[model samples]
Target: MAGTLGIGIITYNRKDTLRGVVDSILRHTSTDFEFVVADDGSTDGTPDLLRQLNVPCITGRNKGISWNRNRILWYLKEEKRCDWIIILEDDCFPTVFGWERPWIDAIERYGHVNFMPELTIEIDNDISSGRGTPEDPFIAPMHQAFCIGYHAKALSYVGYLDTRFEKYGEEHVEHTQRFLRAGYGGLSQHLSPERGQLFYLRGGLDTLPSHSHGSHELAMRNKTIHDAIRHEPLYRHPWRNDEEMFEFREEIARVLPGPAPEPEGEPQLFDSIISLGGDELVNQAIRNHFGRPGPGLFDQFIAPFHTLVSLFRHDFSGLLSTNCLYGYHDALRCRDTLLIYHNCLEKQPGEHASVEMFHAQLPLLRHRFHTMIQEIDSLCHRSRRVLFVRSWRDGFLYAGQHRPAHVASVDFQALVDALAARYPSLDFRVMFVNFGKAHATDSRMMFANTDTPDTCPRDEELAGWSRLFSTYRIGLHT
Candidate 1:
C-alpha cells in the first residue's frame, strides 16, 4: 500500500528562485502527494506569485527558519494527516523525473531522510560512490537542512523544530541530533542517475538571484542557544509552554486562510501612526484604543540594557522582531496605530546601575538614540505622521520624590531635533504625559500601580489620553 505523502516548500524573499523550483517540481515529479508552500513573510511579490501558480500556502510573519519549518510540519502532519512529509527549501530543485519515489521509499525504511545536494567537491565525491541503490539508499549522519523527509510516526516521537533559534544556523543540526538520539535512523544518500542528481543545490545555480537576510550576529546568537540546550531532553512541542502553544494555535486558526488570493490592482500604501516607548504600557494603550492589537515587531517587555544594545547595534532579529501578531506584514501595512515600547531606562530597584553610571554613558546613549530615530524613520517611510509618546520617569507624580538620576542628564530632545531636522518629509511629534499625583487620586491608576513595573495608564484612562493626542496635532515638538 502506498502511504499518503505531503511535500512542503519553505520560502522567504526569493520569488524568482521559488518560481523556478515550483515549476521544476511540477514538471519532474509524478508522485501522488499533497503540496504546499510555507512562506516566511516575503514582502517581495511572492504572495502574488504563489497565487499565480495556484499553490496552497501557509504564511506567517518573518520568524526565523525553524519557526517557518514548523508551520509546514504542523500543517502536513497535524492538519493534512499525511503519513510521510518531505521538506524542501525554495532554493533546492529536483533535476530528475520521479524524484519523490526514492524519498518516499527511504522514509518508509529509515523513518527520516536528508538528501545530499551536489554543492561541494566532497558531496560530489560521495554521490559518485555506488554504495546505495535507488531502492534503498546509504545511511549517513543527518546534515544539511535544505531537503529532508520525515515519517509521521517518527515526527510523533521526535517533535517540531525549536523556534528559539533566531534567523539561521544551528537549528537544523540540533534537530537532527535529537532525531539520532531518539534511536531513529540517520539520513539516506545515494548515487546520482544518468539523467541528473536527486536535488540541485542553490550554490551550484549561478543563473538565479542570490539574496540572504541572515547576519553573523544572528548566527552567533543562535549558536549560543544551541550549545546551551542541545543536550537537554527533547521538546515534543513547538512552543515553550502550554500558553504559548495555545496562543500560536489560535493565531494560526485566525490567520491561515488556505492559499493567498491575488492582490488587487496596484497595492496602496496607507498613512502609519505609531507609538514608541519603553514597556507594555505602550502596547496596552494601543490595544485599548484599537479595540484589538495587531502584531508589533517590538511588542514584548524588553529590558533597558537590551533595548539600548539593540539601538546601538541596530540588530532587530530574534525576540525583538517576532511577536504574536499573525499576519504581521498585512496588518502593518493596513493598521493605523503602532506601539513600540521598551524598558531600557525604566526605574526598578536594583534593576539599573547608579545615576553616575548613566551619566558616564550619556554620550553613547545619545548616539544610540540618534541611530534609533534614524532607523524608525527609515522603517516607517509609508507613514506621513509619526508620534512618540514619552512615558514619564518613575516617581513623576509623587511630590518631593526624586526621579532616576539619568532622567535630567540625558538630552532626548536634542537627539530628536538633529534627526528631525535631517528628515524633513516625516512629521515627528513628541507628547509627554504627566499624571501628576493621579496614582494617589484615581482609584483605577492606584490599583494598576499595585503591581511593580506596571506604571502605564489603565484601560479607562486611554479614552482621555486619545483625546489629548488629537488636541496636540499642530506641528513637530519635543
Candidate 2:
C-alpha cells in the first residue's frame, strides 16, 4: 500500500547536500511514503540525479525557491496521494536511529497534528556557547526541517508558500505561524533508534544546537506585509505577497558569501546640492558623475526621461538621481532627506521688487524659507541632512534700481557667502548659474527677459555660473 504521508523537499543547485538528505530518508523510514522534491531549476547535475532516484520528483521552473515551492504545491494537492505532507530542506538530513523510529513513531502517534523533527546545527561544536548552550536549546519551532505534515485541507486553506519571501529568511515561520493561528497544534519528537539521518553541513545551535538564533526575521516582514495588504490595493495577503522579502533574503546570502567589506568607510568628500528653480542642468549633472551609456546609443538617447522616471518610481531599482523633490508635495514627502524649491521670483518693477523696495516681502519670504529651514533643522536632530537650491539673475544689481534689494536676496553668491559665514561649522555649498542676463529665468527663457540690456557683454560670468551649476547638479544627483 502507498504511504500515508507525502514527503516534500525543496532544492536548488547543491547536489551534494541533496544527495545526503535523500540518502538519509531512504535508510531510515520503514513506511513507503511518496517523497516529493520540487527542484527549482538546478543547472547542476541534480535533475539527472533526481530522475535516477526511485522517488516522485517534480522539476519546477526556477522563478526562485519560493515561487518553485508554491508553483508545485498545486500539483501535489491535485495528486491526492497522501493524508499528510512532510516538508524538508536539502541542507538538512535525518539520522539513522533519530530518523527511522523516533520521527516515524512520533508521526504515527501524532498524525493529526503537525510534526517537526529535532533540528540541530551540527557544523562546529568546539565552542561551548555555540549550539547546545542554554540559549541554543534543542526544542524549538519548525524550521526548514525533515518532517512537517500538512493536512490537505490545511494546504488548501493556507494556499502555498509565499513567493514573496523568495529566498530563505522567514517563509517557514510564516507557514508555521499561520498553522498555529489557524488552531493547529504542532509536535516535535527526538527521533530514537537512529535508523535515518537528517544532517546539515552548517547552521544549527551548539550540542544540541537546534533553534535558529535571533527572532525570526519573518515576523517583521509579516507585519509589513500585513500593513501593506491592509492599505495597498495590489497586495493580496498582508503576510505573504512579499516582493521585499526576497530582496531581504538575497541580501543576507550576498553578505555571507564573503567577509563583509566594511562600508566604504565614510568617503572623504561629499556634496550638499541646493537646487534652484527649473533648469536642465540638474539632469546633465547626474549623467556626468554616474558614467555614460553603452553600445545601444540610439535607445539611450530617445527614451523619454519620464519613461525612465516611471520605471524607477516603483521599487524596481535604486534612485537614479540624488533623491529628488520638486514641488510642495515632494518637499513635504522628502522632508527627511533634501528639500528643494523654485523660490526664484520673476522680474517686477519697484513695487514688485524684493524686500529692498518692498521690505514687506522680506518677512513673508523669510517666514516661508525659515519654516523650511526649521523643518530641516528638526530632521537634522534626527540625523538627516538638508540642502536648498536657489538661483537668480547674475547682473541685475539693485543698488540704484527701485527693484527690491531683497529680490537679490536669492542671489547665489550672496547666499553662499552669508551661509558660509553663518554656518561655518555645518557643511554647505551654493551654486551660481550666471545666465547671459541677470534674471532667474532658465537658459531657454533668457530671450524673454525684456529688461535684459540690448547689448549684453559676452557675459564671461556665464562660464563661472555654468561650471558652478554643473557642479551643483552633479553633487545633488550623487
Candidate 3:
C-alpha cells in the first residue's frame, strides 16, 4: 500500500542544508511518506549527492523557486499520485513531534485542503533557522511546510509557486493566497515560539544568502513576473467575494502571521485594533483634508501609530527590516514605556506598503473594517470603536493613572511635539491615525455625552468610538 503523505523540498546549491533537512525529516517523521527533492540545477554536488541518498527525488533545470516547486508538483501527478504532499525548503527541518497524529488528524478533519504549518524563527547563535515545532505548528504566510494537501487538484489550482522569486520569499504567501481565493479552506497549525526553537540550533547563516549576490538578476526577474501576475491576476478562488477578499488579504499578511498565539498561561497583552474601523476612511479623510492625495497624513499620522504599537505587541514585521525593528524597540522601551510613547511623535511614518499592507489591504473599505477582527484573534468578542479626544486643559486627565507601558491616551501629535522639544536633534512626527467617517464630530460647543444620547446627539457617536478604541488598547480623549 502507498503512503498517504509525501514531502516536496525545493533546493538550489545548498547541499549541506538540504542534507540536514532530509535527514531531519526522515528521522522525525515515521509515517511512510514519500520525499520529493526538487533541484534548480544546483551546480554544487547536490545532484550527485541525491543519488547517494537513494530517496525519491526530482531534478530539473535552473528555473526560479516557483518553477522548481511547479516541477515537483508535476512529479506528484505523473509519478507519486500522493494523497497529500508536504512542501518544505532545504534549510528547514521537521521536529520529532512534527509528524504528530494530530496534524494528520487536522488534515483528515479538513482534508484535501492547502494548509500553512505553524512557523517560528529560531535564532540559534547568530544563524536564524525556521522549522516546524510541536507547539505552534500551524499554517502561516512565511517559508513553511504545506501540509494535509493532496497531490492532484491543488496543483492544478495553485500551479506551483510563482516563479517570480528566483530564490527566496513571496512564493509561499502567493500560493496560500491563491488557495484561499479559490474558496479552499486551509488549516494553520497552532504552535509556540518554544516549539519552533527545538529543531534549530543558534548560529548565524553559514551559507551565502541566495539572492544577495545576484540581486540585480533576481530583481529584474521578480519585476517581470510581478508585471505578468498583475495582468493575469493569479488569485481566482470561487469565494472571491468582497468580504472574503478583505479577509483573505488581512489573514494573508507576511509579517507576524495571525495573532501571536497567547502564551500558554499568560494573559493576552495587545488588544484588537479592528474595532476602530478601516484605515481607508482615514486615508480618505487625509486625501480630503489635504489638496494632494499622495502619501501624506494617513502615512504620517495614522500608519506610524499603528506600526509602532504593532512593533511592540507583535513581531509582525511583514515588510519592515531588522534595522527598523531595532530602532522601533529602542525608541519604545529604552526609557519608561510612557516616556517612549511620549517621545516618539518626532519619528517619520513608514511610507512603503510592505507585507503588512499586503495582508491588511482590504480591496473595499467596509470589508476592510470587518476583516480586522482576524488580526486581533478576537473575532468572537464584542466589538468596540476607538476614538482619541483631547482638550488643551485636560492634558493631565489624558495622562491618567500609572499608564501601561504599552499604551497612552494623549493625542499622538502632542507626543511628537513633546519628544521633538526634548530632543532637539530628533525629528518629531505625527502619528498616522486613519480618521474615517467613524470619528465623532459635533457642531455644539459642548462635547457629546455618549451615555445619554437623546440629550447629547453627538455623545453616542463619540462614545461609540471611545468604546471601540478603549477595547483595542487605545485611550479615550479627555
Candidate 4:
C-alpha cells in the first residue's frame, strides 16, 4: 500500500488569489493528499474562504511565513497524515494535471524536487539555476525554497524551518541549507520544467526585503556558494506560551541530524548598519531590546579598574579626527566609532511593532554590543577612557525600578549620577546638545524631560581629552 501524501499552503492578506488557488489545486493535482492551508492573520475574507473550501486550517499564528508552514507540517507529521509533503504559497497553483503525482514520485527517486514547469522565460542566466531536463534536474549551488516537496522524514532528519527570520525571506533558504547539510544534498532539485506547469503571480512582493530582495543588515547570504552557515539566530515563535515553545524546540532538536561543526575563527563583533527609530521611543528600544546601561554586580565588583567605554552612534565623521571636532556639529563633538547604524531602530512604528522588530534585530545588536564591551574590558585594564552615547528619548528610572511609575523623576544630572555610581570611574561629565525647540511644547518632547545642559562640549572638554583619553582605549584609529 502507498503511504499518505499531504499538501500545505501559506497565505496572507490576498483573499481572491487564495480562493482561486484552492480551486485550481482541487481541480488539478490528480492524486490523493491531505491538504492544509495556513492563514497568516489575514484581515481579508481568507478565513471564511478556507471555511467554505473545508480544508483543515492553521489559524491565529500569523507570526510569519516560516512559522505558518512549520505549523502545518508539524501538524501533518504528528497526525501521520503524510509520508511525503509538498509546501506551496497561496499564489502558487498547479496548471497541469498529475501535478501532485510527479512531485510525490520525484521525492521518492530524487529525494526532493522544487515543482516547476518549462521556463517560457529564462532562469539560469543569473541567480536561479542552470538549464536541465526532467530525468536529472540541475543541482544548483544554492538551496531552492520554491515549490519544495520532500519526504516527511526529511523534517525529522534535517531540522524544521528557522522561524526567527521574518516573512520577508531567508528562512526557507536557511532550511534548505540545513537540509543539505544533513547529507540530503543530492536528493533535492528543481522539477523538470517539461513535466510540470506552475503559475506564479508576479506579486511585486518578490522585491521586498521579506521576499526576494536585498540583504537586511545582518542577514547571511551566499548566492554564489552552497555552504551552510549559522549566525546568531533570533528567539521568536508563534505560540504565546513560552513553556510550550521550549518543549516544541526540544522535541525537534531530538530528531535533527547532529549540530554543525564548531566554527574555526572568532565571530565578528561589529555591524555598520543600525536601523534606529526616531527619538520617540529610542530609550525604551535600547533598554528592552539592545539592553540598558547600569552597574551590575560584576560591574560594581570590578569598579576598582575605573575603565571607560563609550557607546556611540550616528556620524562622528570628520569631528573625531579632523577639523570638525570644535563643535562644528553639536552631535559630533564627542567622537565615537561607527558600530551599528542609528536608523535600524526605526523599522517598526508602534508598541507591538516595536516588540516584533526588537526580537528580530536583538541578536545582531547584542553581538555588536558584546564586541564593544570587550573593548571596554581592555580600556579598564589599560588607559581608562570611557565614552558612552545614547540618544535618550524615554525617561530614566532608579537603579532597581524597571517601569516609569516605580521611579519619581530623573534628568541629565540624574543620568550622570547613575552612570558614575555604576562605573566607579575616575571622572565623569554629562554634556547635552540642543537639537530641538528650547522647551517642550506639550507634555511630551523629543528628548526626555531633563535639565538641558547649556554647557556643551567646549575648551577642556574638547582640549584636555588627552589627560583622560588613552591612545590605546579610545578605539579611534585615524
Candidate 5:
C-alpha cells in the first residue's frame, strides 16, 4: 500500500541553511505530506525565522539529540497520525526532481530506506549478514536516521528504539544500527556518490558538536547496543496500546519561594502586559506607577459608553453604573513608574481628550516619541518600552483649533528631565502603538492644523502624545 507520508526536519541553529532546505522541499517535492520542523532551543534567530515562514515548528528546551528525535517521533506518531515518517536533518536535500515518489516506493518495498544508501553486508544468518563500519549512522533503530522513511506500524513488531542514549557521541548512529539489527530491514539500495537524484547538503555535516567526545560517545553507545541485544534494556517490554500516556508533577513545598527579587538600583521599563486572568490589583499597581493604564478592553466598557452617551445628551454629563464609575476611578489612579506626562499638568486632561495644539504639532510629537522610545530603551537597560497613544475623539483634534480653554500646567520638560536623572542607564521604546485618530493624524494625515504655534505648551500635552506623532512607526498595527 502507498502509505501516508509525514516529513520532518530536525534542525538546530542553521537558520539560513534550514530555510534553503525547507524551501527546496516545499518547492521541489512531488507529493503532499505532513511536515514539521523540530527545533531544539536554537538561540539564534531561527525561531523567529520559522515563524516568518509560517511552518509548523515545535520547540523544546535543549536536552540533547535523543530528546529532539523522541519528541518529533512521538508527536508525529501520536498527534500527526502519519503512517510513514521521513525524518531528515536540516542540511539534507532531494537530488531528483521528484524525490518523494521513490522515497514512498523505497518504504513500501524495503520497510525503511535513505536517499544516499552506503550499505554493508548484514548477517542475520537467514537473509542478512554482518552490517559493518556504520560506526554511528544514528544508533537509533534505523541505522540511517539522516534521511530515512519508516513504516509507523513497524514499531509494533520491533519496540521503540532505545532513547536513553543521550548524546554520548555516536548515540543516534548506534540506535539506528540497533533498530536495524532487530530485523526490521527490507529492500536496500546503495546510493552512489554520482547518482543524480537525492543528496546531502555540504556533504552532510551538521553545524554543531565538536566531536571532541567521540570515543567516550562510542563507548557509551556500544554499551547500550550490547544491553539491548541482551534484552536487559529497561524498555525491552513496551506498552503496545494506542492510548496516550499522561504525566503530572506536584510542587511539594508549603510556602513556595517568591520570584527572585529584581536587583536594586534600576528603574526598569518592562511593559506590563495584562491578560484575561488579571484583576484590579494589577490595574491599581499600573496606575500607581504609569499614570495611565495601557490600552485595554476593560475601559471599553465605560469610556466608549460615556462618549457615545454624551453625544445623545445636550450636557456632556452621563452616569456610569456605580460599578463602572468606581472601576474607571480606580483605573485612572497615577502609577509610580516615571509617567511621561503626569499631574505636572496644572490642569488634568480627561483621558483620550485631544489637545488641538498637540495634534496640530503632530509632526514634532511623532519625532519626539520616536526619539524618547530609543532613549527609554537605553536607559531602562535595554528593556522594551511600549508607548500607547490613542484618541477616542477622532475629529476633535482635526476640528481645526477650537482648542481647549488655555489651562496652566506644570512644566512637562522638568518632569522628563527628572525621570532621566533618576534612570540614567536604560534602554527604551521598542514598540509604539498609535490608536484611532491619533494614528491617522500622525501617520497619514495631510490636513492643515489651525491650532497654531500649537497653543498648548509642551508640558500640557497628554502622556504618550509624541509616540502618536513619532516618525518611527513601531508595532503600530493596533
Candidate 6:
C-alpha cells in the first residue's frame, strides 16, 4: 500500500553509460515504479539508443545540470504526481536485486535519502557509532546528488534545484542545505554490505569513459554564485519570477512533446504588456481592466529608485538584472500587440531628484538610451504594433509634494519621436498621459490614494484608468 514511485535517470551525452545503467536497473531492480530517462540535449545517438531500448524519455536542450534535474522533478512531482521520486545519474547503476527497497523505505522514514555506491571502513565505523540499523539508516551530514530519493512532500517543501548554478558544482550542496533548513531528515549513509547494498558508481574524471561535463572554471563560477546567495533566503523556483516562469514553461513546452493546451480565455487587448516602475498597482489596474489573470513580464518588476540610468546601461545580452531579464524574455514571446507603460513616479517617499546627477550621467544615459531602444526594437520585431504609454510627472507626484524634477526634465517627446522614426514598420505610437493640474480630482485621471503611493486602484478608479488608456487610440481591436 505504498504510494506511487517515480525513477528518473538524468543522462547527457553518455549513451553507453546510460544504456548500461538502464540495463542494470532493469536486470536488478524489482520495484514497480514509473521509470524514464531525462536526456539533457545528448547529441550522441542517445535518442536512438533510448528508442532501441524502448524507454520513455523526457528530452530538452542542454540548460545545465540543475535545469535537467528540475525537468525530472517537474515531470514526476508536478506532472505525474508521484508520491516519491528517485533521481539517478547515467553513470550510476544498480548492484543487487531489489536495491530500490532500502531506498523506498529510507525515503518513507527520513523524507529524503541518498544511497552510497561503496562503503569504506571509515564510513562503516561512522555508521555503527551513529545508530545505523537496517530499520533506520544513518543520517549523514551531506548527501550525494548522483543517487538521491525524496518523498513528494519533502520535495514540494524544498522545491526544485537552483537553476542559477550552470553546468554543475555547488547546486547540490545548496539544495541539501535548503532541504536541511526545511527541517527534513536526510539519510545518506547506509548499512554495511553485510547488512544491505545500494548503487554502483562509474565514469568520473579518473575512470575510463569519463563523462564529466564539469570543469574547474565552471565549478569556480558556480561556487562564486553559490557563496554569494547561500546565506540569502531560499529561492525555490527554477525561474526568478512570474515572467521568467512563463518563459521557462514556454521553453519546456516547445522542446518537450505533448505540452498542455492553452487555457481558454477572451483575447487580451495586447499580445503582451510590459509595465515599467509603478509596482503591482499599475499591473493590477491593467489586469482588472482587460480581465487578465496576472501581470505579464515587467509588470510587477521594480528597479531601484533614482537608478533609472541602470535600466539603460546595458544591451539586452549584457543586461543581468532580474527586471531586465524578465523584460527581455517577455519581449521575445510578444507577437501581435506590445504595450510598454512607463510611470515616472516610482521614486520613494520624500526622495527628490538631483539635476546635477542627471547632468553628470547625461552622456552615458544618451548612449544607453540608444542601446535600449535598439534592443527593444529587435526584441519586438515580431509584433505587428507597439505602443508606449509614457506617464509624466504630473498631478500624482505634485499632489504628494514629491517632485521628480530630473524625470520631468527628460524630453520624452524626442525619445518617442526617435523610436517612431526608427521603427516605422512597427507601427509605433507613443501616448503621453499627463494630468497638468495638480489638484485634478478626477479619480480616472489620477490614482485614488496618492498618500499610500503603492495602493492599487479601486474598481471605479481602474475603470477610469482604462477609459484614459482607451482614449490614446493605440488600435486595441479587441
Please name the candidate that would achieve the greatest lDDT relative to the true structure. Answer: 1
TM-score, each model? 0.49, 0.35, 0.37, 0.42, 0.41, 0.48
Q: Taking the tens digit of each residue's C-alpha lDDT, what string does model 2 give over 295-388?
A: 1111111112232223223321221122432234211112223222222323344323222322334355445544544543443333223343
Off by more than 4 A, model 4: 116-134, 185-478
Task: List the global CA lDDT of all models.
Answer: 0.55, 0.39, 0.39, 0.43, 0.40, 0.54
Q: Which is the winner by lDDT between candidate 3 and candidate 6?
A: 6
lDDT of 4 at 177: 50
The alpha-carbon lDDT assigned to residue 117 of candidate 1 equals 49
lDDT of 6 by residue, 36-70 (tens): 78788889989789888988776656878887888
Residue 299 accuracy (lDDT) in model 2: 16
1-478: candidate 1 lDDT, tens digit per residue: 4689999899998987899999888887778788888888899988789988998777756878888888788888877799989898887778778777777777787676676544443544444333343354544332566678888898888898888898788787777766666655442222311112222122211123356678899889998998788667765577776544543453344223421222435422223434444434554665564444322433332323233333424433222232332222112110111212223333465443334444455466456655655556674564565554434332212221112212333334443554365455665554334322122221111101111112223553455444443343312211
Write model 3 residue lDDT over 175-209, tens digit each, in one string.
65455454343433224211121111111112223
Better of 1 and 5 by TM-score: 1
For candidate 5, the per-residue lDDT at 360 reads 54
Q: Cα RMSD to native, each candidate?
A: 18.6, 22.6, 24.5, 22.1, 19.8, 17.6
lDDT of 5 by residue, 180-297 (tens): 4444443223242111111111122222221232266566665765455533432322112211111000000101121122244434334532211012222332343355454333
Give candidate 5 regions above 4 Å deviation: 115-142, 159-161, 168-170, 186-230, 233-478
The candidate with the higher TM-score, 1 or 4, is 1
Q: Is candidate 1 or candidate 6 better by lDDT?
A: 1
Instruction: Report the number of the highest-TM-score candidate.
Output: 1
TM-score of 1: 0.49
